[model samples]
Target: MPTILDIFKDITKLQRCSGNHSEFIAYMQNLSQKLGYICLVDDVHNILCKKENSNAKIVFQSHYDIVCLKENCVPEIIEDEYSLSAKDSTLGADNGIGCSYMIALMYERFDGEFLFTSDEEIGLIGANGLNLPINANFMLNLDSEEEGEICIGCAGGVDIKAIFNNKKIVPNIDNLDLYEISISSLPGGHSGVDIDKNIPNAIKLLIQSIKGCDGKILDISGGERINSIPANAKAIIATKKQPKKLIDNMKIEKIDTKSEHLSIYDDTLLNYLYSFKNGVRELNKELNVVQDSINLALIKTNIDEIVIEFSARSMNNENLKNLKDSTKSDLEKIGCNVNTYGKYPAWNPDINSFTDTILNIYKNINSKASLRAIHAGLECAIFKEKFPNLKIASIGPTIKYPHSKKEIVYKDSINNVFEIVKIIAYNLK
Candidate 1:
């Protein structure tokens, strides 16, 4: 049987980004057949594999899709003394390692169901649309990043998009100089997990640098993924007077040609971006976790409209609703049309015999095991909503900087987590 690390290495070769998981699905189907396990794909392309007759009534769930940071990201493993990472691209260890654990457990003839979800990186789309027939009474979500901690609950999230229909006017080519202002090299990370880190957002920085500049916005675009803090942004503006001071990690280049169409509502757009509520709004003191937060994720300019996207998360549904409504009202006040979607409910913390069993197994392997709830969104939330009676807990190895190119998984942590998982699977009845 292949080890977890070996399986993870193989998974890195497949292209499993959101909305592009067919290749990975085919690979899993073929592997399942080769391993003599019954495999099926749901309507949303979630792969479910089952062993014949097993007393273990547990489901191991992990998403197969990853956030694509670069084009054709062929992950190159970088090994140091203690961890493994990729070269200039996201390693996809967020859930790839989880998938490997399930595969390894199945290969070892562990009697359990393995659910490989799709499009989880984008907004938990696969878990949201999951209609698979699950027979297990307990669920083990292997998507948590911290080691030695059992995640019992996670924040719910909603995606909000605001569209501004701005009037455009022609710019004079002779009077204005076209300059491209760009911000790069910001340490981008998972929006929910790293929102409180005070890491500068590239889009926000770019807009802030040219806030009061004498310029007309020609085109502006930034951010790659909705779940990731933007690391790079660029704006084309027609300005005669350059801004006095440039922000760090930002560059301004003067171009010879001028832009054809420019948005006349630059002040409104800048004001909105500057006044947007971002980062952690509230923290749960008892749980020591973020209770409410928002990420100004993306900005794009089209011919007639500008679109801005924000991700809002909270542990309480009422808090999430209030934040969403307030944000929508704020955007609408500025003459922007707003819409919110991809809303998933939070999984309230619950500790029972099932979680105690897993916690005991983890403690047996590592003496420092603890139970905690996370600020980030997890598929466990979706599972809880769909199967309210099912017991659920999430565990995984230590992964650093997930959803970014600097993502790495501790070498020893993978082994430790796998051992704990195997023990839980074998003992669960």
Candidate 2:
């Protein structure tokens, strides 16, 4: 039998980024067959495996997809005494570690179902479109980042995109200088989990720096993933004079490049971006968690249009709806088209017998274990929606800086979590 670290190393070698998890799916299917477990795959490529003649029907769930920060990524493992990370890329330990836990359990012939979902990084796409026949009454979601905290609930989320048509114009002045303005080196983090930390968004900061500048926007682009706080942003502006206010961490360079067709937008766009409400909107004092929040996740200016993306989350469905409706109305007032998609319901906090069983097991191993309800979206919400009767609890190793290039997982935490999972599976009825 392979150890947890050995299985995790194998998982990192596969290309399992969002929308490109076919190879990983194949690998899981092959492994299930080799292990003599009955394997089943759904239309959305969610893999489910079960041992024959298993009386106890518990499901261990983990998504196979990860947020790929770099293109053509072959994850470079950087190991230390305590933890492991990747070189200039995300370690994919967000779900990889969870997948490894499930795989190791399968190798041990655990009497339960193993569920591998797809495209979880992109708003739980597989869970949203899941059509699998599930026989389990309880599910253990292995997607939470922090160890020793069993996640019983998570915030619901929706993707909001606003589009602005670019009004192209010919350059009227010949003496205009092309200056590249950039904001970099910001401590970007997970938009949902880190929104309340007051980290500055690079795109918002860049737009604020050039507020009253006498310049024409040539092009503006930044932000890689909608789920991450943008760390860098750059804009090419044709201006006769540089802006008065210079902010720190912003780089301004003068260039001699000239363009005949420059895309420009009115002050409405800037005002809209500035006026947008970001970060935590409300806190659930009762639950001690974030109740409502929004993230200005991405901004891109193309030849024809400027696209702005946001991720809005709320523990209450009405709050989530109101936030999205208000954002859409605000953008529509400014002549922008808005679209929202990838909406998933929230998983309400519940203290049931199943959760109590898992929590007790976790506490026996680590007496400091606690119950938590995260502000970020989790597939548990989707699972709850589909199987309202199914009891769900999420657990995982400590993963820091997920969805960014600095992601790392603690080796000790993985071993401890694996032990907890094994105990839960063995004692599960």
Candidate 3:
């Protein structure tokens, strides 16, 4: 079996974003056939590669799809460490890391099947479509970002999708030209856990920019998935002449932490959003590692409307409600109609769980372990619903900045994670 890093490096070379997963699917099949595994690829391109054994079943799941690219980026290994760097496009560590791990597991001289799923970034179509003989209930989800954390519960998420004008419209006056406005920076992250922190929402920012410029917003939209921080966004605007001046004068405010609320382009909302804020880290004084936060994911404008998307997260369910309410309140006050969605439930940790068993196994392997929940939506929610009696846990090597270009996996952490996983897979009765 090849190292997970090597497999990841090879697959990352193929740009398999969302619907464009044919190359990746074919690649996995080629490997399966070469290794003498029974590879079954369904009509929709979902792959199930098996190393035969006739006992209790164990399944490992991961996806091969990624978000669209911003640039033609090739994954580069940094200093031979487990980490990989991409110049312009996202590294796709979100699920690619897990996919690579699953591929390696098939060749790990194991007695199980590795299910390489497709279209998980958009939906759970790969796993959703498969009709396994109900032979396996032991599923190890290898998609978690952090190495130590073993997530048992995950928030359910729904995409809030809308359509505005598709074609660009030219302004009647010469001075009125179309201009694109965007919100970048403001650390994009997983939505459910990060929403409580007072972070900026790019989608909200685009709308505010429209209001601030005294331009009528023909339409608005933001965010791609309820689980991920929107990476790219755009807005088209008709300015009389000073597109430069209009854009330069635009200002954005930090979200408010105390009240868990924010609004775009409203000075009052700004005051409230930034209120009681020592920035995002200090949102909840009690938590040491920032249990909650918010981010403005994307800001874009079309010929008709300025669109913005935001992700809200919190450890406490009540805080999630407060933040949601505050955001709507602020938008309406700005004279903008309010609509919100991409609602995914937060995954709370189980204090008393088989977590201790995994933690001990990791420590015995001279590694680290963590027990925490995330702000993002996970397949755990979908699977747990399907198999209610299943005792589930999630773990993987440390991954940073998934769903963006900055995504990387710690090289050494993979061995540790793999060893721990081996112990769990073999030791599980």
What TM-score, over all chains together, does every model reach?
0.95, 0.95, 0.72
Q: For model 3, what is the alpha-carbon lDDT of residue 102?
A: 77
lDDT of 1: 0.86
lDDT of 3 by residue, 119-214 (tens): 766555665555544346577778887767777655444332222233333334434334555555445544544455434454555555654554
Question: Which runs of model 2 end up more than 4 angstroms from their true locations?
Answer: 166-175, 212-214, 243-249, 257-262
Name the better of 2 and 3 by lDDT: 2
Which is better, 1 or 3, measured by TM-score? 1
lDDT of each: 0.86, 0.85, 0.58
Q: What does the lDDT read for residue 32 in candidate 1? A: 83
- What is the lDDT for 169 in model 3? 38
**Collision pairs in model 2:** none
Ranking under TM-score, best-scoring first? 1, 2, 3
Question: 1 or 3, which is superior by lDDT?
Answer: 1
Error of 3 at 287 (Å): 9.4
Alpha-carbon runs more than 4 Å astray in model 3: 42-44, 71-82, 127-130, 162-187, 192-200, 218-227, 231-354, 366-368
